[model samples]
Target: MAALTCRQVGNDFFKEGRWREAIDKYTDAINLDPNDHLSYTNRATTYSKMKNYTAAIRDCKKSIEIEPKHIKAYYRLANSLKMLHCYDESLVTFNTFLGFEPNNNLAQNERTQVKTAIFKEKLQGAQVHPALRILSWANCDNDPLSCKARLLAATLEFNKGNEDGKNRNVKGLIEITEGIMLDERCFIIPSSINLAVNTAFEQNKALSPTLSVRATILKYKQRLAQDGWDSVLPALATNIRAAFLIGYMSRFTPDVRNIDQGIENIRRAIELASFATEIAPVATDDINSIDPILKITFLRTLKVHLMEAILIKYKRNIEMIDLFDKVLQLAKEVIESCNENPISTEDTISYCAYYRGHLEEAYGAIGSAYNERSKFSRGELGFQERDLKLLLESVKNYEKANEYFPSDDPKFALFHYLTASYKLMIGGCTLHEIKQHAQKAKECEKEAYPVFGNYLGDIFEKSMVFQALEQLKRPNNIASDDKYFLPQACHVSSNSEEEEQRFIREYEARTGGTIAATMDLSQAAARANAEFLRNGISIISSDKQ
Candidate 1:
């Protein structure tokens, strides 16, 4: 009873700020009831005040084991553990205190502080991983599992490349790419230009060449070429590489070797396909009856043929302009045959839109090639990038194209650019879409720029230049300008001196005309939008970046 009274007195003394008296009383109580929790807890706190942390911790643990819900005992254990530099153990003690007194304000705050410390430590550890660990938060509208499964199936489909197999991959590839574009993770992974560059050097025919599968694909290629054909093998080789490289390895800068190999491969694909078109030169054969997969693949290959030819023939690049030309000829046949003979056509409007974009992409590249060759010769631009005059005339050629067809129809989109360019070529392209079309032309160049950058086309380069100008005008330094995307815009000054002065003033207030001055600050809040792609500037944005 006397010892118990002594422990009570020790608590009263400790609460009353009588340290010496509390120490004497707690020692007496500990001697009387050595295993009693309150006696040890009070004594440990007194030892802690005496700077005996090891002794305090040992006693505190004994008290805690004897009386688990003793809040004061836990606080003492935490303090003693911290003093001994066992911070992790101290955090555990705080957590224990929190569990018992869930509403305790001080304990909650301590737990939060400890949790934050642990999270920071883990984050610091992740910094050493090779591939960056990026984090984002989002929710899926539909099924994320379905999306992933579909992408996986697309990957499997892409491994098979006979004309039939290749066509099968398109729908899946489009589906996956479109979904990924809409997905937060996909853009985070990267999209088109990077994808195309990576694909430029890859082999597409088989994932792992099973001897049987290899023999089968080889036989199919041989059959397509009819054995004596020289170009068929080369073209198949090119298509296989294009599909492989473009399908994988996005987000890294591609090597010049990859670009060269890609150009070579694409060229072969077109040449081999061309053999089919040239066989009956008199135009006697209806090319539409060619296998559906072969028709679309060949047309698609031909469309990109200009892009391939430009990258390789460095000096004689001018030949690229004449070598490349378009014919919705195959597409129109497909559309017509589909309408007339429904059972034969699997051609979707998306396919038509794809080819339409294909035509524009080719035209865009051709215009770029001519402008590039002209620029290389150091004189003047020979052709306008967008031509309204030719489009107006081409309208007659498209006479049978639906009479009530909305001008926004894919055909008009092509006509719009061609006409705008034709008018501009003859010094008459007046519509603003001429410039807007030029911008869309830049969008088409999205696939080319990562591989060829501004070197691909003049209008393409100009579009890049305009984007650089806007980037220069952007508010801060966090935004980086990709000189490769719009290399032409790097230093754009019209022969007109007045517009130059105005541009200089605006640029001065923000970037100050030098990389040094601009890089130090983040970009303006307006242009630093999360979605802005630093890969290329689309100067023709319907709204600001």
Candidate 2:
């Protein structure tokens, strides 16, 4: 009874963010019931929170010794070890936790992170054969995150003309593309770029070229030859460049919501995709080759980008009906193409359905924005009753997309996250529904990370939950004259230097710009390939030591 009272007090202190008080209370509980694993684990957690990792590790190990199955103890121990730079021990402890809770994606993600840390450390120590290290990660209990690592490693190996490289590279290429189609801003881009560079450099060197790394890197500047058959590598590179451009538009554009540059970039991307398709010349028998997936991603990406641009353009010219119809046509084509494919995966089908849902959602949002234009001085469009009707249509399409994923798929989490966001915007959700969806979205992210790995799209899910929770905090009786949706502001800047400066300031203020600075967003295909090759080899070398 005394131990229980102390533990309860400790939990309350912990919840109140009084770490030192919580630790004292937990220590009192441990003194009262020395064998109680919970008391020890709780104290260990408090220590971890206090950044006393050595003491935390000691307490966690004692708790684990008392109760081998104590999951929380394992977690605290691993986390503390990781903080202490005990990468190998942390890796083992995480594996121990997974032995009992195999399906815990949170644990899986943590473990993958530890593994990556270990890999980077080893690479720094001049450990050669990156493919071998990647294989170890890939074969780790058939975990999806490890499988992705293996695919990337194998692709690099194949680029070096190592045995088993051809088959692994082909398979890795396919999987990486699939990952990009699902979400563009994952770790897939960097891995794929690294692999492509090694392969291209090696191939270039074999053709009357020296094996020297410097000579190989120079090959990245050379243009790809116009082969009669459109090989997968060149086509894949085009798609990657296109995806990067779209991301650049979103991230680098002036915050005044100016999207003219974005629109031009999208047009250029579409032209690149079209040219790649024409040059590839797929035979009837090879229809299943990169053609279907590449075509589908290009069309869907184009539709989404075009719709965003159209929404911006619609503010200036309400008569963008023709352009809107064209985007709608693109959406339909994506859906039809997915259904017609003989080898389409369930994931592909779900993606196509999700794309269609976005089309409907965008249409509804634009209508709502147009209707609420009176709220802003720049909007000349008038609202109609049909605009509300379109919003309802948007909700229904989102629900339909959710159905396409079923419960087992990772993408299902994304649908729930998006649906919750839309529901919040639509203003009809009860507090209970909002809470239910927000929690489910969080759980879904935890579930999906082991499968798809973390993505930039997950930021939207986090924002949706944050916004929805803020809405829930407001009183029900609250009333405001503000419109639910308004057209974006007009940002017309003629001076390129001023526009660039404004964008840098706004973007840094919004996202802190630290991570953005680290990401390589080169527009030139040859340059990206070359840079990766130069850095890839240098990641681990004897001379570095």
Best by TM-score: 2
lDDT string for model 2 (1-545, tens) is 99999999999999999999999999999898999889899988988787666678888989998999898899888888776556778889999988888998998998999899878866755342322223222122122222233233234333333222233343333344333433332332233443543454344322222223233223322333533233444544434343434433453344435465566556555554555555454446433354543454445555555555655565555455665455455455545544554223334332322433343334444433333332222234332222435445555655555553434234456556655544544444333354456567667656544334453254744564443333222122222210110100001111233443454455445556753243211111112222322233222112110
Q: After superposing candidate 2, which stretches have Cα over 4 Å from the reference?
A: 1-90, 93-179, 187-252, 255-259, 275-282, 286-329, 346-387, 405-435, 445-545
Minimal lDDT window, size 10, model 2: 481-490
Q: Provide the lowest-lDDT 10-residue window in model 1.
A: 131-140
The local distance difference test score of each candidate is 0.43, 0.50
Candidate 1 C-alpha lDDT tens digits along 88-180: 677888878767777888777766665665566457553422111111101111122232222222222222112222344333333333322
- Candidate 2 Cα deviation (angstroms), residue 256: 7.5
lDDT of 1: 0.43
